[model samples]
Structures are given as structure tokens and as C-alpha cells.
Target: MFELSRRNFLSQGAAGVSTAMLTSLTRGDAPVSEKKYAVVDEVAFRGQTRRLKLMQGDRYMAALIFPTDYPTHFRLKPELYPVCTPSGVPVTDTHQYCFIHHQSIMTGHGKVHVDGTDHAVDFYRQLPYPNTERIDKFHKTHNLFQMGPSGIQKIVKADWKVTDQIQLRLILDWQLRDKESSGGKSVISEQRRYKLFQRGPYTIIDQFTQLSPHSQSLTLKADRHSLMGVRVNDLIDPDDGGMMHDSEKRKNPDGNYWDISGNRKAPRWIDCTGRIGNQTAGIALFSHPNNTRNEFYSRGWGLMILSPTLGHDVRVTKDKPLQFAARFVAHDGALAGKTADELSDEFAAVDYRKMFETEK
Candidate 1:
């Protein structure tokens, strides 16, 4: 064999290393040669027949599923809202349905009816506002509203991904029937589009910029005029209005509700700021302009609620579709806006497409 010099030996070694890396990169199913990022696995909860997955990547992100089934709905309280004291003894309760996190609040046992009537359902918890005394006020529903079979099918395309930012897309479709009212019987059919983006660990840039092109042409028929509003509640205080002073209300009289202010003919958009567990969360609500009622916002720190009706007496006719879209973006710190005027301006500038389209 020919003797090799030290330089030649080193050159050969470098060539071998480069070849190996090239091969690994070109291989279709090669084992990972480098450290891989974390991946989330599928998890199942009570009342969820199908398993849901939590995904996290360069950024921490998760989708909290809330189902419409009564068993699952009632189970959410203790499972997700357990009392955790930073310094004191952790409270424990054997009761299946208890608001132990907010010990001062009363717990009622009942089911949410089809007519949108829910007994023993705390509106404060379900639709809370600022200065509310109820503790654990910001508790979210177990899942988004139950969309039934057809509605669920439409959302198959809906999912979320997180990279340096968070992106969420949801498609909701449903047929509304009017069985309660007689006058102005008609059908309202439409589709809603929602998108959100996030930057940094806690800063969220949200957008509710699109509606189905077909939505503007559709007229939603409701027995009574229906409007969509946001509901916000604080979860850290007692269950009643104990901490709210009359002066506080006068100082910030908005009452945590923000109406979707825009043209009633095209898709209407609203932007608001709130807090989630000390972390600020941005919200964007979108609806078609032809919707019978204007969009309303029930917005508050620790809680955010969106209602399509004011008196809860609204009814949708057959063949009509009632659709709404919402986006939640976690921010790095408390939001900068102090009033709706300031908040709306900040929301208007957020570029939704860039937030969702950027690769992590």
C-alpha cells in the first residue's frame, strides 16, 4: 500500500464526513441524524370519543377542546379549574360538579337546553364582565359551541400550528331552524372564516379579515333581531359583584363589551384586548354584514364571551346558517390599549395572512 501523508489522511476524513451528511439529507426515510424538536401526542378526555392532539414547536401552543355533550361540559369544572394556591394548601373536593377554584360562588347542577337556555349555568362564568365578584371568572367553556354533525364536518379543515408564531383557522357551517316563532319566518345561510397569528411567546397579532365571498349575498332570517356581542369576565375575585365599586364602573363604563363596528353589508370585524392568566390575549370576532343583529362583544380579563343575541330570544329559520368566527392570540405581556378606541386601532393594523402563512 502507498504511504499517505498527514494532510492526505485529514482530507480523506473530511470527504467521508461530507458524503455521509449528504446521503442522510437525500434519503427519503432516513433516521433523523440531528436532534428533533418536541412533538405533541394525542390525548383523550371524558366525553371526547375521539382523541385530540396538543401541538407545540418553537412556540408553546395548545387547543383546549370544549364539547357540547352534557357529561363532558359538566366535567370541565374540576378537571381544568382545580384550586391551586401559590402558597396555601391546595383545595380538594370529591364533588363531580363544583367550582372549587372560586369557593365563594354557588354551583348549580343542570343541563344546557337546545333553546340556548342553560339552568344552573353561571352566566358570570359563561359570560362574565369586568368588576364581577365571582372568582374563577375567566374559565372558558369546555369547548366551542356544539356544531352538530354537519357543522363538525365543515371544521375538518380547521387545525392549528405553532412555529415562532401561532396560527389558527376554523370553518363553521350549520343549518338553523325556526321552530319557536311565527312572523318573519325565513332562512339565514352563511359561512364564517377566522385566522390568527402570534409572535414571541406571549405577543399575539390577530386578524378576522375574511368571510366567505358568498356570505355578503346571504340574508340571515331570525325571528327576532339578533346581534353578536363579546362577554368578558374576571376569574380572580369572588363569584358575585363584591370587588366592583360604583366609581370603577363610572371610570371604565364600557362594561367589557365591544360591538363589531363596521359596515353591515360586508363581513364585520371587531378587535379587543384581554388577559388570560396574567398573559394578555387578543381576540378578533368576524361575521357577515347581512347578519340580523350587529355583533356584540362580552369582553373582560380572565373571561371573554361572544353572544349573537341580546335578550336570548333569537331564533334562526330552516335552511339558514348561523356562523361566527373567533381567534385567540396569547401575548408576551399585558395589552397596551386602555380603551376600545386604542384597542381597535392596534387591531386594524395586524396582518393576519402573514401571521398564518409564515413557516415556523
Candidate 2:
């Protein structure tokens, strides 16, 4: 059994910085010194998918990757994986033994079309399948990440810009284009925002994606593959030892119920937890207001996502992008000691629009 580390990572850095740099380099009144500053390091991957690691006080906090395959130009999945506890135990799991389709911590899926070809891709998995609704990548979408006052951001030359910054909460903003979707060319644009932060031992991630058709229109067919989610470690999966709770106060006995809620009156959130290492660790997924789809999808054996596009076919043009938004919270720990309603109350208090202006 592994003993969990409860060290406070935010307290380990050097303190007392120059009044000038503090004001010039950080967000709000966060007295950041040289030691507490976050850093990013890019490393090599075996293929086109490059990896970038984020650090604070020089300790590993998270990693982002661009999962791209060359020969097929499909499966261009982007992810933030292996999120760790203060003591360094990876709280999230990937690369599983059973469902093999779970190699992601936070990933996105949408079927893009051009000339009647099916480009609905799932960058999350790398396998041949009966689950054949999978393919990956964009014609010219390049992903990038960097460290700043807003936190870590992912950029794609000019087509995509994502900022994962910290204010009262960590806020993520993404602005991108539908590169080469219409007859093999960039035609549409999308903007997204996410806010995440940690409270006690829980980490909360909230996201919103907006669309603009520019001059051409984009279509999103109703399917079970969309939104960001996680695949829990086997130790905490229902088939192994975990339990799942939904807003209806109902429990899913196991993972076979992945997205069962999507087929019915979906709940507001789902909570899953079990013994991680030697401590009781888990994840609770929350759905917020204004989402396009009324249902949420959840599976046992550790998989959860917000299927905002389920059964709702969408046609996006420059004038009609605000018709939808997929917003959810991925929180670490099973309320630890609080109730789902209490957690929901806390999530409700976050307002990412009140962000700080980046230092010039």
C-alpha cells in the first residue's frame, strides 16, 4: 500500500520578490517570488505528439501532450495527463488494462466533415476497433503550451490559442479555427474557456467551448463522442473497488453503464471514488447550466464525460455559435467529507469572466 503525501506544494517556493517583478509577473496580489514561480519544459516524443511538463517550486504538477500520427494525419488528440497529489502520487489514471480506449485525462471529440467524408475522430484511443467511430487530427492544427501568470497555456501557431491561467481559480481560454474542414481548408473558428482550482484536497476543472462558422458552416451530428473527461485508475474503477453516485442519488454498480445517463434524464454530476494508494481518493464530475445537451454520460470501471451534443444535431455559422456550451467540473476526491450539494455550491461561486489583465 502507498502512503499519500499531504505536503502543501504552494508553500514550498522562495518568497518575497521585488515589488516591481511581483506586480509585473504575477496575477492579483499573489506575492510570487523566484521560487514559487511556475515553469514549463518541453520534451521529445517518439512521434509527432510532443510532450510538455509544468512545474512549480520545481516539482512536477502536470503534463500536456499533442497526440498526432503522421501517416494517417488522423488521431490528433491533445491531453493533460498524470495529475499528481501534493506528495507525488498520480491521482488520475490512463493506459488501462481492460477498456483499452482510455488513454486520456482531459480530451475533446467532435465529428468534423469535408466533402462528405466522415472525420468524426477520437484521439483518445490508439487501436483497431468495433468502436470504429475513431480517427484523429486536423489538416493543420498544431498544439502548443507555455507558462505565465494565467497558468499554463496551449497555442497552435495562429489557428489555436489556449490559456490555462490562475486567478481566484485556474482559467483556461481557447481560440481556434476549423483548419481544413471545408474542402480541405481552414473555414471556421471556435473559442473556449475553462476555470479550475484546488480546495482542500479537491481539484476542480470547468470548461466552455464556443463556435463561429466564419464564412462557411459546420455541422455536429448527434453522437456519444464529445466533451472532456477522465478514465480512472483500475484500483478505483467499479469493477475493481469503487462506487459511482449521480445527482438522482442513484448508484451505477459498474462501468458498463458508461453514458447510461445520456440515454435517460441525466443528472447534474457524478461522483466516483475508492482507495487510491492507501487513502480514499476519487473524482466527481459536475455539469453546469447553459449546456446544449440536457444529459451527462458516465460509465463504470472509471470513465465519465459530458455528452452535450448527444442527440442534438448542431449547425454552426458565424451568427449562431452561442447556441451551446459544454460546461462541467472534474473534481478530485469524493467530497472528502462534504456532500455533492455542498460541492455544487462551491462550484457555483466561480466566475472566470472576472480575469486579470496579463502583464505587458
Candidate 3:
């Protein structure tokens, strides 16, 4: 059987794992038969809620938490929480008083136009009109925090498959709140998928998102908050000695990351590396070249986002949906720029269609 040692895995990184796997398949060699990791359901908080945990051997590596508590779960969005390094230190955070809506890793849109309507919906904030405007301008870091939004993501159907990777497939209804009626209106149908696998010293998370109008046409307006987002641990935030780097070789040393170089050019990847206790860990968010390619939202305050519709409006119909994919490489150290580029190139070369095609 093919076996990879921890030392070799750490030395070569995830790219080497791909090469090894492909070589093993090509040479008809024995596979890595040992099941080193697994995805399982975990009950927590006195069994009030359940979550999906990615377990490496007997340790926790990551989790998909469905928040059911007050306020945070009001938005009805599940969060990827407690993303940990190989050594078992969490690199992600959630439910911070500063930004209660923020998740370790999440997805949402700010301004969504249904059937080309004049009013834009703020799914990102999940807040209604006036509240959304109020919260946008309110920046007192120490003041009382309010529930950002009320828009709900209703899970219509969900399925999970485990192979070399653990994949979670969800069909969700993006709904808007109605004052007179309950359960909101389903405006958009979303197909969101997450695949988690181990690649050498990195825990790779590949996200695939597809959105279509429920029954009418929909337009995703160019809003700053629309797309996939991640929030690193506060201890790793740039404000707290962490470092943010992008494909343009720009680093955020001063709290101001509005350089817009990578955002405007749509860099292949952006990352943040920092020390937690005695371990140095990092997370690199990679954009596929085949994506719509728009501005990236990078912040020094522990937030990184991929915005595909930030520059222009994207229209979608029931038949024609808007789709995109991204890869999150969470490793136990800073990744070199060359390695980041290589990983980005490898992700760009993936046959996403075949990998995510509807199984027959």
C-alpha cells in the first residue's frame, strides 16, 4: 500500500499529494488503503443542535455547524466553524461580539434584484432596508451589536457523500421576510456544495456555488458584500500581528489593505498567516481562472472574501444559473508565493463540471 509520512507530506505540500495520487493511479500501484479521516455527525450544546465534523484520525479538523441559537441563527445560514490546523489549533472564529453575523466561512449576497426589480435585497446583511442602512453606517466597535439581518436560507434538500473527500450538497431557498406573512418568500434557489479533503499538511476545502431564480429572472447587483467569505481567528487577524498577502505581492502591514491591486486584477489567491500560541498557520483562498472574475474583498480585520459580481450586475434565470468555485487551503505555515501560484494553477485546471456533475 502507498503510504505518505508526515515529514514527507510537510516537506512537499499539497501539490505533491496530487502528483503522488496521479502517479499511483497511472502506475496501477496500491492505493493508500488506510482511512485517516472521516466526516461524522456530532451533537453539541446539550443536543440543541447537530453539526457535521471532519475528523482526522481521532482529532477534530473542522466542522459544519448549523446555528440554532438566538440571533446568530436567525439568518438561517450554516457556518463552517473551528477550522483547525493539523496540530489541532483552530484557525477560524465565530459568534464574536464585534460581528455576530460573521462566520468562520460563509456565503451570501448583499444586493439581489429579483426580476430586475428596483429595490435591491440585502441578503448579505440579512437586514431589512432601513436597518441595513443603519448598520452600514454604524461603526462603534464597542457599542451594542444588533442582529444584522432576517433573510433566511431554507434548506430544501441535502445530501452527503464520502470518498477520497467528504462532500456536502445542499439545495437551499433564499427567502425574504414578509411582515404580514411568515416563512418568507423563496426568491432564489441555490445549489451549494462543499468538499473537504486532506492534501499533505493542508486541509483543502473546495466550494461550489450555483444560483438561479425561483420562478422569475434575478439580477445580482454590484454590491460589496456579495460572495463567499472567511473570518480567521481574532488572534491571527492582521490587527493582532497576522499578515495578509496576495498574488500581487502586496502585504497589509498597516491596517489599510485597500491597495485594490489584487482586487482590481482579480489575483489568483490571497492569504493570511499568523501565529496562534506556538504554531504558525495560514489560510489561502484561491480563485479559479474560469470564474466570473471580479474584485476581491480583503480586510486586515480577519475577513477575506471572493466577490464575483462586485464590478457589474449578473443576471440569472431559472434555466440559466450563475455558478462559481473556490478552494481554501488551510495549512500549518505560511505558503510561498510560488506554491500558492502552483496550487492556484492546479485548481484552475480541475474539471469542475465532471467533479460536480449531477450524479445519475
Candidate 4:
């Protein structure tokens, strides 16, 4: 038998690795078009709150940030308007009184108790805007911040990271901090990604929230509200003929979502759809399997809240911070129908870790 020398073994091993890598690269698992680079731009608006818009490719998504010194304490859905279908049909409602608090899509709703506040914070409704007359003037950023609404969460600051150097996906980042939690610290971290497909387009929103008190514990009552929810356009109002469905195949008839009706049954996902002008479009909330709870505090007035309640109270301290992972899909078309099963099934194939990959 012929024996191979150490140098020969090293050189042959390196060659084998190089050859394997070359073969895999040639297999075309990664397309060059998807890796192509592009450019991005930003636009800002100061309404009742400050809003920021990010234009990536042909799609634009925005955010609403509660400003400093606002009597109410919280940042609402930044995606209030211009959330259109792939063909350019609007999916979000602006200025509807039925449920004025349904501010497009939001990340709030719960009676939370911080160390310094005696009242339970209601992030679900606009406590600051009492009547239709007031709300009409409330959506602008230049308006004054007042009190007498529900409990408010102070807005400390907002930070964002966006880039278009790589194609395939539009990567965006946001880190939001709340005013001193009376006696603690609370923050919301979101990483939003948009993928435009030939079939349609969808946004992948990933959030991580931390509630911690500097010297005390924060208590979150089993709430009917979610930290995140979707508010649809008025045209698809249950009164205007819209459909609300859950993954278990439970659905409410058209115009049924116009009231305070919804399911306590925890499903894997929930969705709502309505015809906007000429196009049929909708939004869906996908509760990841890893979420701690799975129920919806949905409303017929075009609000779908993916919050789960324990019918009791739970305490979260710095040591036991609350965490969650979920996704929202926005699409339009007969092919992009609001069927939770089909959507959920299609979602299972998603590699979230890869989709939400950071820009590094």
C-alpha cells in the first residue's frame, strides 16, 4: 500500500473543500438578481404624531411615533395610510369614527400597571381624543398633546436603521423606548422586511418587547387587547361588507366585523378581507408557534387584535421580561385571498431566520 505524506493530505483536503464550495456556488441556490443592490429614501410628516416613510423599490411603508411630552404615552401604527395593494389599492383606513382608535395597524392594548402610575394604561383606544370633532384634528403632529384620555405611555425616543444595498428584501429596523416606567424601563424593538412577489407583496414584521421596572415589578393584566393589532380601511368595514376568519376555519359573515364581536378561541392565525374600490385586499396576523398565548380580542369595527388573555394577572420583572414573535401579511388579489389555512400553510415554509436576517 502506498502511504500519503502529511503535506499531500493537507493539500488534498484543501482542494476537496474548494471543489465542494465551487460546485455548490455553481448549483445556483442563490440567484444574482436577488443579491443586486438598490437605493432607498425617507420622508417625514408631523401630524398628531411624527411619522416616517421609507421608500424601498416601488413600495413604501411608514411609522407613527408618539412624540415627547404627549399626554398619552405610546407609539401607534405608523402604517396608517398609503398601504396599498400590489396594483396600488389602499388597504388601510384613515379617519373613520366607528372605531376611531383603530389607527390603521397598531402595537398596543392592555391595562398595564407601571410603578409610578395608579391608573391602568389603555393603549387600545384614544383617550386623548374624546369626540369626533377632536379626533378630526388629532392625526396631525403639530397638534398639542393633552390629557384625559386613557392611561398614556410616554414616548422617550425612536431609532431606525434602513438600507437598500442588497436586493431580494427591504430591511428596516426600529427601536422604541417608553418614558421612564414610573420605576422601570420598557422598549419595543421591531425589524420590518418587505418582499415584493409576482403574486403580490407582504410585509414580515418581527417584534421583541421588554418590560422591566428599575426598582419594581410591572404587572400586565390578562388583557383583551394585544400589543399589536390591525385596523382595516372603512370600505371593508363589516358594515360595508368584510370578512373576518380564523385558522380553525371560523369566520364571521360580511358586515359582521362592524361591531364588538370576535373569538376567544385561540387559533394559529386570523385574517380579515374587504373589497377596496375595485381590488380585493386584506391583512392577516400569524401568531408564531413559539408565542406564549394564542387568542384574538378582535372587533367588528375593522380591528383584529391577536392578544391572548389568561383571565388573570401576570407579573414581569427585569428577570422575567415578556417576549413574543409574530408576523403580519398584507396582500391583495383573488389569488391572495384571505384564507388562513392557505396562508398559514404557505407561511410554514418561510424561513424566518433568513427572512429577518440583519444587515450586519
Candidate 5:
């Protein structure tokens, strides 16, 4: 055997070690795995009284304690319409107008305004002109800044389960109260409907549902002699403006009255895109049968708006409680249609007796 020199042996060892280190460095950083859930507890926002908690689990998620207080300086402002898209692009600019009330969650703190007020108006104000009278005149009837009943109680959770396919469930408790108007001739009925929104790796999804069964279905019934506004492609022509004046009316002449074009009236229903976990989701709105104007819908890719007017006429009747119910769901395109249909069925099955049961 040939003997190796001390310097030769040391130099060879050093070279081998350097090569190994270089190889390791060139491999880059290790990949990070996605978390199954995320939890946000007691997140204090600018204008809210209650401490909000958000939880994300493997198959279930929740938002607890939504605030009911509103601030006095609140003014409605414009916000981006159709906040989400099936193409996975979010609307970043506000092009539409809605009320923005202010409030603080915890007491003794100066009032802080939040965007949730604007969101609430944008999400709900979609009825056609004549039908949308109530919401348009909301301020004249009641103070926007005062604290109302707690809309959401305890834990509000949404769950998703995967079998051969994916399924979703939303659970919550809500309250309703009637506030006397200054005129005393009429009363403004307050109903707190639950709103749900989800944004993930896929696209965007927004949905709303009534937490109580006491809510009425969305239905419409105008006076017998009252004119039933002509619908041109998902819009109602309250003014009877001919199709030549409106482009949307020209597109779908045979569509429902609520679908007509040139009709500035808010829509009864809306369909928009929602995103989740590298998948695009579809969102739809449904109403209960007891509603006066049976609900109608607007289907599209970005945001869907459902009008409260679509459920009933806004004539204030003393002691006649105005009831409403709604449901929202997020699903892949494949299940959007089926999910919407099922939600409609569920709304129809709701009864007054079932509405009062305490949720477990």
C-alpha cells in the first residue's frame, strides 16, 4: 500500500466536505405544507362592541359575536360591486353606493367606523325601484347609529365535509325586534339575517341565511289592479321605459320581469363567484315561501344581490310582524345549480313553529 502525505489527506477531506455543503445549499428551501385550519380569537376591530372570534378547522369554521351597534355619523358610501369573480379576480374598487354606519364593539371606547356597514347595505339593497322603497328610506324611519338587538348569538359556524364530494352546512342563532317610529303611525320591523363570506385559494363566495325559522319566505304580490312591471332580462321596468332605452332589456326580452334592463329597480336575487382552496365556488340566494313576493334571482359571475322587497310588500302594519328567511351556500361550479335548488327546497319547508326552536 502507498502511504498518503498528511497535506494530501487533509486537502481531500476538505474538498469532499465543501462539495456536500454546496449541493445542500443549491437544493433551495424546504416546501411548506398548508394548514388545515386557522383561528382568530377576540379580534377587536375599530367599531364593534362584542369580541369577535374566527375559527377554521379541517371541516368546520365559525365567527362568533357580531356587533349590533351603529354610529350616528354613519353615512352611506360607494363600494366595489360584485366583490368576487368566478375567474378568481376580486373587485378592488367601489363603484356602487350603500350606507356605512359606525359603531364600537367594546364600551367606553371612542366610536370607530368599519366597512361592515357598507357591506351590509351593498349586499342587501338589490330590489327594483318600486319594490325597494323601504330600504331606500331606511334612515327616515329609524336612527342608524343606535344599537339594535344582537344579530348573531353564541357561535356562528360553517362546516365543509368531503365524501365522494364536498358538502357544506351553516349554523347560527339570531334575534328580531320592532322599533317604534317617531310618527307612531308605523313601526320599523328589525330582522337580523345572517351573512356569510369566504375567500380562499380558489375564488370568492358570499352567502346569507336566516338563523331562525320564524322568518317568512321571499314572495311578491302587488295590488290586483296594480301594474305588474314588465320584466326584461332579470330586471323590472318600473317606469315602463321601452327596451330601446335599456341595453340589458334588449339582451333577454323573455326573461323574468325582475331581469329587465333599463330598470333601476334593485334585483330580488343575485348570483356571484366565490373562491376556496384552489377551487372556484358559486354562491346563490333563496327565500322562504311565506315571503310576499316569492324570491327571484340574478345569476352572474361576480356578485349576486337579493332584494328584501322581493319577499314582500313594504306596507307597515301595526303588530303584523314582518318575517324573512334566506340561505347562502358556496360550492364548485358542478354543484352550484344543485345547491341552489336544494336551498330553495329547504326554505320552502320552513315553518313558524320550527323557527322558534333554540339551536344546539
Candidate 6:
């Protein structure tokens, strides 16, 4: 286990920033000070996607992409692309064909129900199958909704606030195809927020998802893929040369459902690490203690998901929305189990769902 002290982490950042500042001076440009550097910078919001750059000083850390198109894009969701380590090695792969739905760092759910309706909607697996790159057929008609097997999450509104930390809030309508017409019905109103900050040598992403029924009550049925997911780069996949570690210390070599249990006990955090170029980099996902069902689906093929609705049914009422929170750590080296535990403790101390109450 690699134990990294707080002092060592700051020294590492200082060393890198010194070199970058020197390079800027050589180029005859005004050097950017560490204090004035923006962590999250909006790159572009056009066409079918809204992209943001996660940065450290002048270097690129990651790209957060939110798909604006609905049924047109097979997987209509937000994800982090090319998540790089501090040394500039990409630690996440968003273009893995075999698991096209496995986005770099995204959120998803499956087996959703709208009160008394028999509508079985899935937003996890996605359309046109997982392995194929062929696009799912889109209706060219003027109908507002494109009927398909996948549930669509259209961003009704998106707003961001950049303080010491960056907060991106999205108001989405979880729409499902209406079996009666060519249109779709909005079953749920979702408020998703991503609060990002820098901690030590890690870029910490805090995600909070609140789902309320549009009109009727909602039921999130038991599903293997319910909430947050992290798809590591191919180089870090265990099949290539990576490793996975969880709070429970359970080993899953075949990507099976070993951690999915009838009981409520589950791992608090999971880390996936491997060599990216010459540096060891990885991501750690931590589940909030307040979550009702915090199960995980970890795979050796570079996919790790913290599924909250697995093996249990969750009810979401109008008065009380189904709210859950998670934390993702993107760091340059293999995160230690002790460090994961400490981070998980810190995560549990805060109620991240409180931030979701206000619409900034």
C-alpha cells in the first residue's frame, strides 16, 4: 500500500507548477499564478454536446462532456473523457467499443418504473447493443420524442457556478417512449449536480443525483447498474495490467456479481489502478454512508459502478425525492486502502445532498 502524506502531495504539485511557470516565461507569456488558475474551464457548448475542461495550472486534467441530443445520440448522458493523471497520462478510455455504454466517469440507472405504469425503462445498457458501433435508428419524423428501448434524459436547463470549487447543475427530464404515440412521456424530473475540487494530488468529483416523479410516484427496481460508473483506460484494465481493491477486501477476477448481496452490507469505496505510461494512476469511487443501497459492480475490463438500487426496490415520492451522493478520486498513483478509508470517512461526514436543495 502506498502511503502519501499531505506535505508530499503539495510538494509534488509545487514542483510541477514551477516547471510550467518557467515554460510560460520562456514563451514570453505572462506566467499564470497558482492562485489565479481555474480548475474547471468551459471549453464549448455546441451541436450535440457541452464540453468542459478540468485543469491544473496550465495542464489538462480531464474533459467533462454532456450529450445534449436525446434519442439521436444512443447514450444520452454526461461523462468525463480522457481523464489524465498529474503527469499527463490518460487513465480513462471513453472509446472502448466492446462496452460502448461504459463511459469514462458517468452516472446511469436501470429498471425504472413510474408508479402504476408497467413501463420498464433502462438508461444503463443503452441502445444498439453494447459491442456494436452502429447507431440506433432515429425517427426522422417531426415528433418530439424518438421511440426506442433506451430512456432519454434531455437537459432542460444547465447552470454552473465557479467559486473556490466548481459546481455544474443540470435539470433533466427523464423521458420514456410512450407506447401509445410516437412521442415520449416525462416520468421523472432529475436534478444532478457535479461539485469538483482539488484535494492533495487528487481531483475530487462529488456527484449528487435527485430524482422526483414528474406526476406520479416512482419506483427504482433492483438493477445491477443503478448509479455511478468509472471506466478506466484500456492500459489500466486488469486484462492489460491493472488491479482493483475495495473496502471489503473481496476479490473479483471475472467481473461477476460477487459483491451484490441480499443484505444491505456493501463496500464503502473501490479503487482501480494500473500503469499509465511510466506512472501508476487510477480512480477511486466512494459511496456516501447515507445511501440506502450502496452495492458495487466491479469488472476487470476497466468498469466500476456503484449501484444503489441493486437487489432492492427504492421508492421516490413527490414530497421526498430519491437522492444519493458519490465521490470520485482521480489521482496519479495507486490510491492506498488506508487513504481510501480516510477519504470515505471524510465523505461520510458531509451531507452532499444538501447542495442539491438549492438550484445555483
Alpha-carbon shift of residue 24 in model 4 (angstroms): 38
* Ranking of predictions according to lDDT: 3, 6, 4, 2, 5, 1
Please provide, for model 5 over 1-360, each residue's C-alpha lDDT reduced to its tens digit, 9 standing for 90 to 100.
999774346335433443443354368632111323343334344544333232222222233233332353211211112222222222111212221121101000011112222211111111121322334335775433443221222124444443322233444322222233321111112223233334332222222223222233211222111111101111111112111111122221232334333454323333333222233333333445555443232222122223334333443232343444544443333233444454556556756323423432
TM-score of each: 0.38, 0.63, 0.79, 0.61, 0.37, 0.78
Pairs of colliding residues, candidate 6? none
Report the C-alpha lDDT of model 1 over 1-360, residue by residue, as the tens digit: 999874356335433443443354467433221222232434455435232222222222323232222344332111111111111111111222332222110111112113322321221122222233334534465321221111111122345554444344544322222224322111122232323232332222232322221222232222111222222222211121212111112211223332343222212333333332322333333333333443332212222223344423333333333333233333223233343334344554544433323432
Tell me, by lDDT, which candidate is best. 3
Candidate 5 Cα misplacement greater than 4 A, ranges = 1-51, 58-270, 274-278, 297-303, 308-312, 333-336, 352-354, 357-360
TM-score of predicted structure 3: 0.79
RMSD of candidates 1 onward, in order? 18.3, 11.2, 9.0, 17.7, 18.2, 8.6
Residue 295 local lDDT, model 3: 56
Which structure among the candidates has the greatest TM-score?
3
Ranking by TM-score: 3, 6, 2, 4, 1, 5
TM-score of 1: 0.38
Alpha-carbon lDDT, every model: 0.28, 0.47, 0.70, 0.49, 0.29, 0.69
Q: Name the 10 consecutive residues with the lowest summed lDDT in model 1.
A: 83-92
Per-residue alpha-carbon lDDT of model 2 for 1-360, expressed as tens digits? Answer: 965433222112211111232344345543222224243545454544455554434433446554443433223445556554333334456656665545545644444332344344332334333332433443334211110001112234312222343211122223122332322234334444444443435444455555455455667666555556777655666766678777767777332233444535566667777655445556666665555555466677677776556566666666566333332333334553347767766655654332222210
lDDT of 1 at 314: 37
Q: How many residue pairs clash in each candidate?
A: 35, 18, 3, 19, 48, 0
- Please list the residue runs of candidate 4 whose C-alpha ends up more than 4 Å from where it truly belongs after superposition: 1-49, 62-82, 115-118, 128-201, 253-264, 335-339, 342-360
